[model samples]
Target: MSHSVEVYAPQNWTVEQWNFVVWSEGAPSNTFGRSYATADWLLTQTAVRPLVGIVCGSGLGGLADLLKDQVAFNYRDIPNFPQSTVHGHAGRLVFGTLKGRPCVCMQGRFHLYEGYPIQKITLPMRIFKLMGVETVILTNAAGGLNQDYKVGDIMIIKDHLNMPGFAGNNPLAGPNDERFGVRFPCMSDAYDRELQQLAVDVGTELGYRDFLREGVYCVLGGPSFETIAECRMLHKLGADAVGMSTVHEVIVARHCGMRVFALSLITNQAVMDYDSEEKANHEEVLQTGKQRAEQLERLVSTMVTRIEYNNNYS
Candidate 1:
């Protein structure tokens, strides 16, 4: 690191803010200013004022395809946005209506293993907040840790175990920006209970009971899959599923006072037995997602329509 480079931080910036700007590749420390810039640019590109924001997970880019009258921007074209380098992520920010409600969906999302700073990983949530998104729906591909969970099951995230946060890499680690939320945000009720129930009701109506289940998801910083021992430990610790993303985004969205609902598509059962020949791989994750893509899309699209009528979020 060079000691001679003195970067300019906006007036009244805190030390934590300065550190994030100097370290975060995208300089996402300016929660209000930088996010507002992206939001303003997006507004200029499309007239849609999204009330709900959706994040598409691995092998789930099809979620964006459901948007009607779509307008989209590549991550590179979006100011201060980090590009998605991983395969399976289309890396676009799509805006349109879902069931007649204006919405924006991330065709792909960022992850810790992508090498972005923690702040950069959660920058899109702030951008979504600035874009008039009141409710957020996030989806991801996860390895089921629960022995009873099947590969094609869809787990409604009722809670999460943030392995990264436990290691001091939380997205909210930087200076507290009142413009975003309180210095110490309450996360005990992070996943909105009402939204969870709404999803349950919708899933039942759609006859998805066999595959729809609710459980705790655990997020790990990963490009590599979890070890057998690690999988066993996480399951014992109460995480029904494990994944590499979604937790950070959910934290940021909730920090900014957005109603959050998350879903995990169990793409593969975690390799919990050392003697078992099953090797956890990315190809299998996408393949399973391909098989269940239509059902996942239907579940979300139906829930989106009813979200407006749900008095809790409205």
Candidate 2:
């Protein structure tokens, strides 16, 4: 007689339970192979070997449009890629040149709240590294937690508070893959200082200082906007801006020894006062992105050119 075994499905499970299942499976053995395959396919599609990989934040998909000689692939068409479900995210991978430097830009990004395993969410970073990307630039729209920040301000990410990681919910939570990185990775230098300085210099040169600020970012597992108390607590803890993405991608990129640069557009002020009537909404986020998209694009493209110059001739 044969015995029937019931498999526990993680589909309807809690986040904690789902994370346990993902951890148990470990990092997929085919990660590198799959990334290599994808990279090879992309190379065949375009002659550009990207040195820079960009992950655009909410409503910032337009950044990829600035690329010269662009070739784009939708997430669904790319092998082993996760689809983007959020509005304002276009779900495409674009390859081209930025200021004559080869680059790849993700028009959209996946999130933990979208029911994707953390590893899957960060798989693109590994693929980017395998595609010969040496540097990663991440941009996101965030809520301004610092009282001094105004909507539409660009906040350079000097540091970040990974609130999810504090609770053992991290992109690096699964079994370590030697091919990608060491078991224990250092995050202290995740965001490159030289790139941060370059961004500041570029913004200054563009006369964007009035709306450009630098501060600490906080990442939270989000599909819901923060409560006033939560906003107050994060602000008290020194978080100047708060968002749902970036930190995970940064962690993965750093693990693979890629240089990282990230910035947040403060789309709205966090509601810290219980009596305040203002509410946070995605429309506002997209609108703010539209308002600053041109300037932000100019800043990033200029930074890309400077990074290329520094690497080649400095």
Candidate 3:
């Protein structure tokens, strides 16, 4: 999951090199530039400056509605923004207050499976960093890969195995913009440990002691679910939850020195040991995601409040 830093010579340019610039046609001088421009427009429209950014996963758009003094911006209205075309996802940006902290929420997100490039998929995270968001809470709907994982459980992502990154596809692959981050960024602990413990403590206080689990998330690029062999391989590689998104954004966030906390809503089992003719589908994923939305909302809201208070007064 590491990128090699090689100096590019124009005469030695490969087709891949040409495609890299083509893929990132008008990405600002840096991600922060693009983000700040968008945030300026958003601030003008809403009069709120977001300190934290939350990206909503499948069937979880309702979390954005809970924000007070909310201002909405459709993805179509943003320049160079790709629209999310998946079911169970609402493509909008919401600015408002949650737990007395000004926050921004992406009610929907773009995925690599949606025919977007890596840089395009991670555009929102860059914007969040530019807009002064120091921390990010990313949520997703994923299939449980661990044998003990059950339906409707909430698993906190501790680390991730990025298959896309391993395959030479990375959001930070193109150019080394020292203005945004270092050429080689270390990712020893992608998810913030303190924020994770806060989530665990919050869940416990809310009587979710037994249901909250923490483990590694394996990220792959997919619109289609995994095959049995793929599930087995992922399990062998130490993943508790497997999904299509999050890892790319986490990398972008970390590159910009933003703390990240991620959670996965276990929508269905990975179908590794299933014998019934019944299969998993998006409908079930959406249903389970909705079922657990309320608890997720409570946990994230409390965590945000605590983070703001601790950072300001502690």
Candidate 4:
């Protein structure tokens, strides 16, 4: 006997119907179940049990190459994983050791502008927690919003303004899962303080004080760069960096009780003056990443070692 299975064709669905079927279901329990399934499959593929999870931002995917004894899986090969749509994103998960600490790195990350449901974008955070990862290091390429910031600088994320969340577009918008976190999670301490300080100390030790900074990052829904007016308003609102990713991932990681540390590589200066000839472009972002990639790698690797030492001693 033979059995046939039917799959729903999204192409035939109306726009409203599609939205309802995807986002309206919220963070379904099955999402958690599928994450476990994915995690199990990963375990079978590699002997590495990671304690740290890193998500590469924009052009920062080179960080993953520093890992030793690596095992990698393409997004297309991973069950239920979303493929990256942006250039400069390699769309792979790499498992290995960085400075003797077991880590899993997402060579690429998903974004809201990619048309993925918010829950889907953050699913990896929960999977990281389940895989026994206690710390998450997030990196991104951002436009400098502070007047004092210049292109090719690195900013440790101190806080964030979720511009999209203010309008009800939040990763945690779905029904709360007690298995993952409380119904109301605090954002007050979203970015780990000690890690921020550790990054500062690491950068200083690496002689990166001249360009190292710490400040608030504001997230805007983008595939589009901010307009001059928007850039000016963000600067006045106290943001030092602006980008399309990271904020949502941090929220999800914190919700699941993982320690979070994030940094932004200032790829370009946001145009706050209409008369200015400056424009924000992805090509410039990629170029800046290449320019500062080595230093950023050194700083993060040093921090990872320090974190491992601290965990062992304290």
* Candidate 1 lDDT: 0.87
**lDDT string, candidate 2, 1-314, tens digits:** 00100011213546454344334444465555455556656777887888899999999999999999999999999977899999999999999999899999999999988999887899999888767788899999999999999999999999999998999989888667776788899988888999999999999999999999999999999999999999999999999999999999999999988899999999999999888999999999999999999999999999998884224210
Which residue segments of model 2 deviate by more than 4 Å?
A: 1-28, 308-314
lDDT of 3 by residue, 1-314 (tens): 00111111234656565445435657545444455455545656776778889999999888898899998889999865679999988899999999789899999888999999898899888677656677899999999999898998999999999999998999999777765678788898778889999999999999987789999999999988998889999999999999999999999889877889999999998888656565779999999987889998998898899884224210
Model 4 per-residue lDDT tens digits across residues 1-314: 00100011223646455345434454365566556556657777888888889999888999999999999999999877888999989999999999899899999999999999998899888778767777899999999999899998999999999999999999888677776778788999999999999999999889999999999999999989999989889988989999999999999999888889999999999988878997789999999999999999899988888884225210
| Least well predicted 10-residue stretch by lDDT in candidate 4 | 1-10
Pairs that collide in candidate 4 are none
Give the per-residue lDDT digits (tens) of candidate 1, residues 1-314: 01101111245767566456545664545566667566767887898888899999999999999999999999999988999998889999999999899889998989999899988889999888777788999999999999999999999999999998999989989778876778888888999998899999999999999999999999999989999999999999999999999999988898888899999999999998878999999999999989999999999999998875323331
> Candidates' TM-scores?
0.90, 0.89, 0.88, 0.90
Off by over 4 Å in 1: 1-29, 309-314
What clash count goes with each model? 0, 0, 0, 0
Q: What does the lDDT come to for candidate 4?
A: 0.86
User: How does residue 18 of candidate 3 score in lDDT?
Assistant: 42
Clashing pairs in 1: none
